[model samples]
Target: MLRRTLAAVAAAALAFVAPVQAQAPAAAPVEIQFWHGLPQPLGGLLEKIVSDFNASQARYKVVPTFRGSYAETMVGAVAAFRSSSAPHIVQMFEVGTGTMMAAGRAIRPVHELLASTGVNIDFADYLPPVRGYYQAADGRQMSMPFNSSTAVMFYNKDMFQRAGLDPNAPPKTWAEVEAAARKLKEAGIACPMTTSWPAWIQVEQTLAIHNQPLATQANGFRGMNAEMRLGGALMVRHMQNLVEWQRQGLFRYGGRDSAADGLFPSGECAMAFASSGLRARVMREARFQWGTAMLPYYNDVAGAPRNSIIGGASFWVMNKGPNAGETGGRSAAEWRGVAEFFRYIASPEVDAKWHQDTGYVPVRRASYELTRRAGYYAANPGADVAIESLLRGGAATDNSRGIRLGGYVEIRTIIQEEMEKAFQAGQSAQQAMQAADTRANAVLRNFERQNARAAQ
Candidate 1:
């Protein structure tokens, strides 16, 4: 009886093993981790996207992890790379392009990945300015653009009316902005004007709007041998104007980047310069009527009204760990999944929805057309200002594509410090600007040397 029972069990095992050995094995689900920096509402939105993708496909699972602010997230990604446990995808800010590109063998260029996977992604479909910033000199896209934003003017309609200014008309030039600020201040407004990201608004945008080069080598688009040229007449003059306005009480200097966005939304400031990304927050928090306008420009500059630069981030794919093998030389299945995800995010419908919800400019021209057809701009008023500003010109110059400096965060801090000393400590604008140029150039040189050694 015992022998018969053992024989029955052995036969059952043999039957199962024979079938398993003869048949093809089921493919294991590929898991890809996405590390991002968006918090709160944005973070939740990203999670929803990931959830939808997971539900739509069984072959791959995308897991998203919030890794804090942009700087913290970047540092964390670097540490993870060291441990060979980095996420497959990372959301890096625009400033980190130089650093990411410099990290050899760490990242796989987006265009190369798509091509290897046989995905037909047309880079031409992307807006010029958006593509220009993310592309290499040879016109290869290094990463995928996700959240993009340009600087714009946000004004209080109620305040404009109170000052007897036309709510429908906003200042188009620096001179007009000054005139409006003076009127608003005289009308009993405590803070007639303020701005967020002074380094970006006052310096970076200043260069782009004035059609002036911020650095010698087209704002470091060429290489790290670039030097700061922001001490030019245009930049100095603009800084001086701000200093004078601060003294006249027409302009209130707010704490560093994005901290003063709340002041404008709260009705404390009549007008403010901020990123287009602030649209959702402003719409939600602002009690009074507000309007958006193109950034003010210097009338004297030849191409005074050039397009502004972008401030948001992009998704960089890191080649690390065991998962890298899954991408292979040309995994059609995996490539299709990635291309589909990009298409979903960049599709006209999705772009329009994102724009309506977050106030970010739609990346595709078709998305803008769809939004216009839906009368979103007409219903929301100032909603069209950002798009108009972005499309004011045909194509972006090297300068208009924006700065790509290494150690850009430190450079921006140096710029902020010098400007603060000039505006708050009563230092001369020329002196402050010259000092900033020197300091920034030192940082550039240091980064160049460090990267050069890394290359060797």
Candidate 2:
């Protein structure tokens, strides 16, 4: 009789403990997939930032995955979509804007996603040059600008002084750049100047700076029927100048993509035209005093000093399932998690930290203002050059607006290939550009045909 009484008391105590346990909250985390293109050294930094975000709150967790280069990462994202495993966020290069915008059903526009949660992001709050490229004709941002950057002139201060040029007074015009390069060459420097992304910096950016057309139909902003305007008289003159520079030994080709990122920082070249993102790499690699300046432009050309174009990448939200919440019209648990994460990233504190840590321009106006108030620019001279150049015109025009041509990435390849023959002295600038135009037109026409079908 005593044993039965003891068992009943134990059962009552167990039942009481179970109710308390059931009343407590669950600590389970919502997972969101994030894929990017930064390799090794920089990838570690990305991982750290993502980790910090994940640890900041209990609402969501972001899984950071290094996909590959921008082009490769984009391909990977598309493949994932096909396989029904699309990432919550994918980093796409600026040139891919047209292609992504064309992929109608694949992505949920950022503005739309955020609006579902009753939050509206002001387009005016973004830097004009950075936002213009990603905006639709109806004036809405298609994706979130993560790492927007512009082309800038990076130079070795030591080499500048050694070449008898004032390190503080960087060349402001293409003529001045040529003069400085001549002096550096005369100083017995083997490689006076080199450039990364020759097509991007020398051709595309130069066109924009001169307020020239890259293609018809507003550089493919209007419609898919745009054709190449890169073979115009202005382009011909620019190419002729480049070919002359090559022949004069004043300019050296430093390969493509980020291959020549090392050339300037290593002190092998006095100057380079590369993306503003190279600032971080130069700081880590350069043994000499280095500085940045606005990209040199042609003084003779009308409207020659317009704002430069933006490079770098942004986070594009994939549809068909990024969040796990039940799907329909209302915001699901997954979308709320995604929006929360975006707010974390777009916050001024986070944006400023990212700008300081990397060389990329902060996309948000508030972030830029915050960074300026922190005296980051005053302390670090030349850092604000990109910002100043980007804000030059107050607003972007058809000529100064960024390139959005379909097949832009492929056209870039054709440009580089044809320009190679000119650099090697095997063909004239006119001939090289003509051939490139023919090849580029083919690509553009093909893109038109493909997208026309998609639109239909």
The candidate that wins on lDDT is 2
- Candidate 2 runs further than 4 Å off: 1-24, 321-331
Per-residue alpha-carbon lDDT of candidate 1 for residues 112-216, written as tens digits (9 for 90 to 100): 777765666666877777778888766789888877888899999999999999998988898999999999988899999999999998899888877899998
> For model 2, what is the alpha-carbon lDDT of residue 432?
91
Number of colliding residue pairs in model 1: 0
Please, what is the TM-score per model? 0.90, 0.90
Q: What is the C-alpha RMSD of each candidate to the true structure, in Å?
A: 7.7, 8.9
Residue pairs in clash, model 2: none
Candidate 2 has its poorest 10 consecutive residues by lDDT at 322-331
lDDT per residue as tens, model 2, 1-456? 677566556655654554344335674566788999988776787788888888997666789999989899999998888766788889899889998888766787888888976655566788888888888766788888878889999998898998999999999998899999999999888887888998888888888888899888888888888888878898999899888987889988888777788898888999999988888888888999988999988888876788988998888888753232223212255566677778778888888888888878888889989999999998988788888888875677886778878888998999999888889889999999899888999988888888876554
Predicted candidate 1, C-alpha RMSD: 7.7
Off by over 4 Å in 1: 1-28, 321-340, 453-456
